[model samples]
Target: MAKKLFMFEKPLGMRDTLPFLYELKKQVRSVMAEEIERWGYEFIETPTLEYYETVGAASAIADHRLFKLLDQQGHTLVLRPDMTAPIARVAASRLYEDGNPLRLAYNANVFRAQQREGGRPAEFEQIGVELIGDGTVAADAEVISLMVALLKRVGLDRFSVAVGHIGYVNALFLEILGNEERASVLRRFLYEKNYVGYREHVKSWPLSSIDQKRLLDLLSLRGGTDVIEQAKTLVTSEEGRRAADELAALMAALWTYGVAEAVKLDMALVSHMSYYTGILFDVYAEQVGFPIGNGGRYDDLLAKFSRPAPATGFGLRVDRLVEAIGETDVRGDIECIVFSQERLAEAVELAEAKRAEGKRVVLQHIAGIRDIDAYSQRYRSIVYLLGRGGQ
Candidate 1:
């Protein structure tokens, strides 16, 4: 039997990023990782494929979104949809058993089987860090502060990290909806900002007028610093109150760390991922309709791997971050342009010398024809080969 050959083109939702754009994306990741490392996080890597049971542990990532496959033994595997879950597997298994907080960072590509909508790339680049073992609210504050500092350093003119605690949201939803599945559906409607869907879903539910109003209010609970105080009044459950207190404490820590202004207490900021057990946040910049960065405290994720540890991390979408920064604003002039026809060797020597001195040079070789003057327009100086029109 002959093996079948496949005709191919680059798949949809995947793209070849060109030179300048690619460099800009790299710069963004480098700056972010530098900032992350300075804050004590070490870099780590995880496999692209993992067992089905492991990847499926996180409730936030949908099954349909995963790029699934079967291995040689017929066991299921998947291209990781998110880095956190894989990181959790490693941390729990034996990578960080020192009992100290493990601070790790990664520059990774994640694959999603979901269709590309709104120009969303199916192959996404993520630059992120996970702070595991420390469950304190201060850890959350530090992570949030790092996010603000990172965005500012990356030259975002206007952006804010909208922060929320999932505990409060879970409690509030469970308080009204009374079941996880129903509450999840409502959470999606709110996350999508689809008020019509939310209303339609709520109409048939067994709840009072005041509770319905409260649910709508939850969706609208977003704004400046003052909104935190307002969230206090809406708390009906002890869990909600605890979440509010945690948020307040985080804000206080952020204020002390000089990043309070970069944050907005957005109670409406619930994430679709059920794994996010505590702080949840998204970064919104001007001109981009989607989040350029997001992550939250997932205290429950590691426990699924049999390592019960609290972890807080965040990931910045490298492509989105590059888009937010706009075009690369590089300024320079080529030091020399070597124009040569017969004297290719001379042109090469001149180019090499200039490049060694840390100057940009362009070498143009022709077949004893073509104007050197035409090339002079693009560079600062022109060098002639074999003394032809010697400058």
Candidate 2:
């Protein structure tokens, strides 16, 4: 029988990032954490594994996408697909009992079994903030403004935070003489950005001609602040009008936050987070094909765990961020290398002295090397003669 070969491979949707890229991610995290702290968000963390019954109790998407497994005691557990639900659980249970209106920050990894639409990655490093107990349009604006500031800190100048309201589509869905379940079928198509399916479904489904036209127009309508005024004319529901008003107010506030230039009003932004009761957003940057960050308001989720309170937040994709803004490489200065074994101890002492003085030193041993010049070039280090006659 032929001998079999051994091969190594990383699991699909995961890979080891090289050192330069790894360091670059660290730099990005440092900048983001500094900004998060400056904004008064106290850092917090959640377990990677949680009871399936905890996070899955609210939304179908969350229930299905979790990386599920049985724990040691045979309890259903899962690798969290997103932090929002887990944070909500914590807020309703622990934070709510202790304090109110938490401005919490966290750095975490979210694992999802399925890939997202438009080639979104499966595993991601998520850095985020949540303002629990504050539900006003101001709270919503603060999240978006901070997103702008964070992107600028990371050297990403060309980007836009697309402000949206889930109520925009939900309002229309209610008006079309269909139950939410029926309307959800259409909403799913929109979330997938499946324009053909959306249009065909709308055409065959029972809807007033005027409502159909307005919904289509709403789908296509995305622009600067003026688009809010356009939405006021097109959407009829009180909820829809209030959503537009709230969006306009939030944009005005973003101006005060000095990030209005980065704000874009996209009325069609239907979020995957089902519990979002109000403003929702997606951050896009130039040279990157997909969203680098996402956030919104979800008031209903916390109620499922312990208490009901208004909350809004966002998460930035560290992997996608470095992909958009390429990683940085750190170069070292001229390193001092000592080759002779006899000189090794002296070289180490000298290297320590230099290191104490804040210089980079490389100590190496070479026994047979005759041409020191070749070794210097090969190691890219300066050889300091200490133990030989040159000493």
Candidate 3:
């Protein structure tokens, strides 16, 4: 009997990134790392699989959309759907004794079970950073400015960083509704940018005319620092005032850092993650429909690890970022593609020498002219024939 040919297929909603996409991913990560290192943030890594309960506390991943399984000990484990939760676990268990304001970064693949409508893949790479132990406006400013710098470094020259305070939105809901469940529902509506749904959700509430006006006003809050003045009028609670003040200070600091032009304010902006306790934000490029990166202060996340330290972070979806940047045909400048049949050793030595001096070299064996030209056109490689001596 003949043996059957074996082939592998990727799971649903997951894909094997091809070579061009992989190169684009690498470039995006390199740009992110360079920008992060400029801000004195160090790199770190955590396990891909985590205790189910640890991530279960986060509303972002608590849902069954996580890919879960049982461990050898029969304990539930989950492939992390996001990076921040794992980073929080790491900070609590490993770096708990470290000094204040630890800045750490990571680049890793995260897995999630897509609900089919989210239009996102189940497995994707996230390049992100965490700032722990500091919750001051200065820290927020530093992180935001670093984000701006990173985006600029990555060739996203026409992007904007839309900043908001979750506290402001939470405070408004708490003051008007005083019901967590109702507030969560409204938050979901706002997060989806379903202004119509938000209106419908609030219609049944017994909010006063003033509260109704305030809520409606928030939906239109977008622009520069001037938007904060409007935010103050929309939020009546003391907590709301504090959130606005923090945003004001953050805007001022960004101006001082010469990044104000790249920053914008959005009072109604809400993060999908419910743990964010303070400033929340997302970066948007004119060319993309969704955010290229997002993050916010999750002062309460570390508490889940039993340490209760304040923390903030942001992450770039490297794939989406590269897509926003558009693919470049970087293979066009290839100056040499050395071909060898009998002189493999010599070809390899010459290729290595050229590569060491920063030259692009491809060493391969070709049998005929047609094959050589085909390979050259495929890779946009320049052909160099190696014969007996120098012909």
lDDT string, candidate 3, 255-360, tens digits: 9999999888989888664767899888988678888888888888888888888888888888788878887864333455566576777777777888898876
TM-score of 1: 0.85
Estimate the lDDT of model 2: 0.80
Give me the runs in candidate 1 sitting further than 4 Å from their true place. 1-8, 56-59, 116-118, 176-185, 197-213, 331-349, 359-382, 386-391
In model 1, the Cα lDDT at residue 90 comes to 85
lDDT of model 3 at position 144: 82
Best by TM-score: 3
Query: Across residues 1-391, which tens digit of lDDT does each residue of candidate 1 receive?
Result: 2343324446667777776577688778888888888998889888888888776546357888877889999988988888888888888997769767988888899887757564878889998888999999988988888888888888897888889888888888898778999888887876787878988878777789888887877767776656777777777889988888898899889999998887888786766656688888988888788889898898888888888999998988888888888876543456654454656667788789989988888676554436656756656676666546455
**On residues 230-257, what C-alpha lDDT tens digit does candidate 2 reach at each position?**
8888877788788888988998999899
1 or 3, greater by lDDT:
3
Look at candidate 1 and tell me the lDDT of residue 176. 78
Candidate 2 Cα errors over 4 Å, as ranges: 1-7, 56-64, 115-121, 331-336, 357-362, 367-386, 389-391
Error of 1 at 232 (Å): 2.0
Every model's TM-score: 0.85, 0.87, 0.89
Alpha-carbon shift of residue 151 in model 3 (angstroms): 1.1
RMSD of each: 4.0, 3.4, 3.0
